[model samples]
Target: MNLTQLNMLSDAQLAARVAQDIPDGSYVNLGIGKPTHVSAYVPEGREVIYHSENGILGVGPTPPPGQEDLELIDASKRYITLAPGAAFFEHTDSFAMMRGGHIDIAVLGAYQVAENGDLANWATLDETYPPAVGGAMDLVVGVPTIFVMMKHVNRDGTPKLLERCTYPLTGLGVVSRVYTDLAVLDVVPQGFRLVELTPGNGFEAVQAATGAKILT
Candidate 1:
């Protein structure tokens, strides 16, 4: 393989990969930050509907820079457009859809994920940063299938995937899969299972970068 293929996937490429995994005719909620990019790259002909907590369903892709509509924004306040058959409702009603288990999948950002699929995204242990979990608590509990999108390691060159989360957890045993810059992992009964590694990468490298033990 070309050396370039070994490079970590960019945010857009990661989003595309996540989009490819989503099945057709599903209702998905893209969490704040990186997860938001997934909707723009849904496969052609798939009828996946995007949902926003601020009261909109059937969300479309992000609009061009100059075409942004101030009133239509996502949970992160990022500008977004609506699909052809979109529907808008009260914010409470939106939570109803989620709490009622009407949502099929939810792609979220995480600060750290435990080997057993525990999620810690809202805040780190440091009291310097105030916690702003928002709808993440609700989303994890309500959404049946939770997919976490994050980097393999923290910015300080430490692993974010841990044996047990040090930060406050959003949900216990909630995550099903994790899409990181280095690999795609499944949260199995044993621990994190290596689904696939990035091109030109190896199991040893990923194991070294990860804090928790990967169950082959």
Candidate 2:
């Protein structure tokens, strides 16, 4: 089945889905780009302490218009507000929080995710896109649970969830779950396991769009 025929979740909807699974009191680090949106959709009654690689320990949602704080930005350079009790420290210290296993969950955007939980979000083989490893290597190693948020397929309709990554890996066997526009899946010892599908999407259709086998 062609992916274009399926009713996929929008980026905001996908982020909300990811947010629902984050347990209360989780110390999470949101990766750049799409994963950053998860911070805004955290479920009510849940308290998630967001950590930024740029040195903020209590990252908040995007500020309202006319309330932008130019000096306060995430590693992605996007303007962000500070949650209550937010703390700032040196860049090295921020990395320490990530590398020292202080973070419980890390939601990351990915280029390719192998069936065995290999992540390749940093660098692609495409020459036009420059490689940037950033703090991903550290997060995947230190964070206990890694949630990958990304599109199920590339712009050319090629699957990003693959049998093996074609791009440079950020970490091996680290991803715990993946939330994509098409479906949610878990990376188990055998391979990708189906968790749930987007509304109106079928398991066969999603599996057809995936580059690797998705076990039921």
Candidate 3:
């Protein structure tokens, strides 16, 4: 679908779309924000393991109202139910899992991603907007694969997937793929490659929204 049309998809629908790409036995970490929706999309019968930086593994989903444990929360501080064999530990152990390369894939949200795989999600130059780096640095370097989920363009029609990032970067060259409303792009040795386009979007339209050369 086109960028605008992509919004018509329910959160459940978006979750399903992301789940299709997950391998059967991936050990994944979903970042706060939109990436968390991936947990709801994981296909039934698959053995994917979900990890949260707040020290939970094999997380299930948001708990039903009145069923939440005030002490149990995901990285986003949202109350979540635990899956079978789910474990909780200290934050140190959590970072160890991330920094020690135990994670196979990390899906995160981004504000900007350059054609060369540079990420700029933590901060901007806006004086009124405070900055926060959070755990992005650890996730980027710790995970083998980093997939960014965000809109293709800024509010002012500026491209977020760009030839170069105008915002301050979070990681130098860490992003592996970008999943936007219009398309999916893979960062490669030769630059960004247009891997998949949304159903009703054309390559040129995506190219126009991205200020970078896209390999077909």
Candidate 4:
């Protein structure tokens, strides 16, 4: 199969796909970057509780333009509003929730995820870019399920889903599934398990794009 860009999901579309997987009444932590957008697209019938590292829990979607409160922000520092019945707490208590296994799922962006579920999202090999890992180390360990939302390829068109990660790891064998622009894949023992593909793409094209073996 040759490369084709047809039907590739935009970032918002990918965010919606991640949102649809979350179950009702689950306490979730959406990490900085693309994962933060998941807050806005949670399924209509489900009630998902959002947790943030900077002392916020039960957070809500980001406000529309001009409705933003610069003072109120999540871990990503994105201006947001609180959901009904949302609570505010101390930073230590917030981390306690993440570290104490209270978070059900954590959706995070990744630089790389290995076949065995090893995750490397914190820093690249370049020392020039200082990394801020924040609560990622804790979330991946405590949360029962980890879902990564990221691009299928780097800017230079290399696979981010790989046989092994070259970057510093945030957690080991922690990723359960990954949602990317090209496809949705689960990190199984053998390798990536195909879930669904973008329209107009075939298994061969996806296999070519990935760095690891693909298992149906």
Model 3, range 89-154, lDDT digits (tens) per residue? 889999999989999999988888988889988888897987788888998988889988887777
Ten-residue stretch with the least lDDT total in model 4: 1-10
Report the error of model 4 at residue 86, Å.
Answer: 1.0
What TM value does model 2 have?
Answer: 0.95
Q: What TM-score goes with each of the models?
A: 0.93, 0.95, 0.92, 0.93
Point out the worst 10-residue segment of candidate 2 by lDDT.
1-10
Each model's Cα RMSD: 2.9, 1.4, 2.3, 1.8
lDDT of each candidate versus the true structure: 0.89, 0.91, 0.83, 0.88
Writing each residue's lDDT as its tens digit, candidate 1 over 1-216 gives 122334577888789888999999999999988998887788889999989999999888778989998999878897888898999999899999988899999999999999988999998888987778799999999999999999888766689899999999999999999999889999999999999887767887778889989887
Ranked candidates, highest lDDT first: 2, 1, 4, 3
- Model 4 TM-score is 0.93
Off by over 4 Å in 1: 1-6, 64-68
Clashes of 3: 3
Best by the lDDT measure: 2
1-216 per-residue lDDT for model 4 (tens digits) = 233543467999999999999999999999988888887788678899899898887798778999998879989888889988799999889888988889999999999999999999988999998777888999998888999999888877788989999999999999999998889999888889999997677777788888998899
- Considering only N, C-alpha and C atoms within 3 Å, which residue pairs clash in candidate 1? none
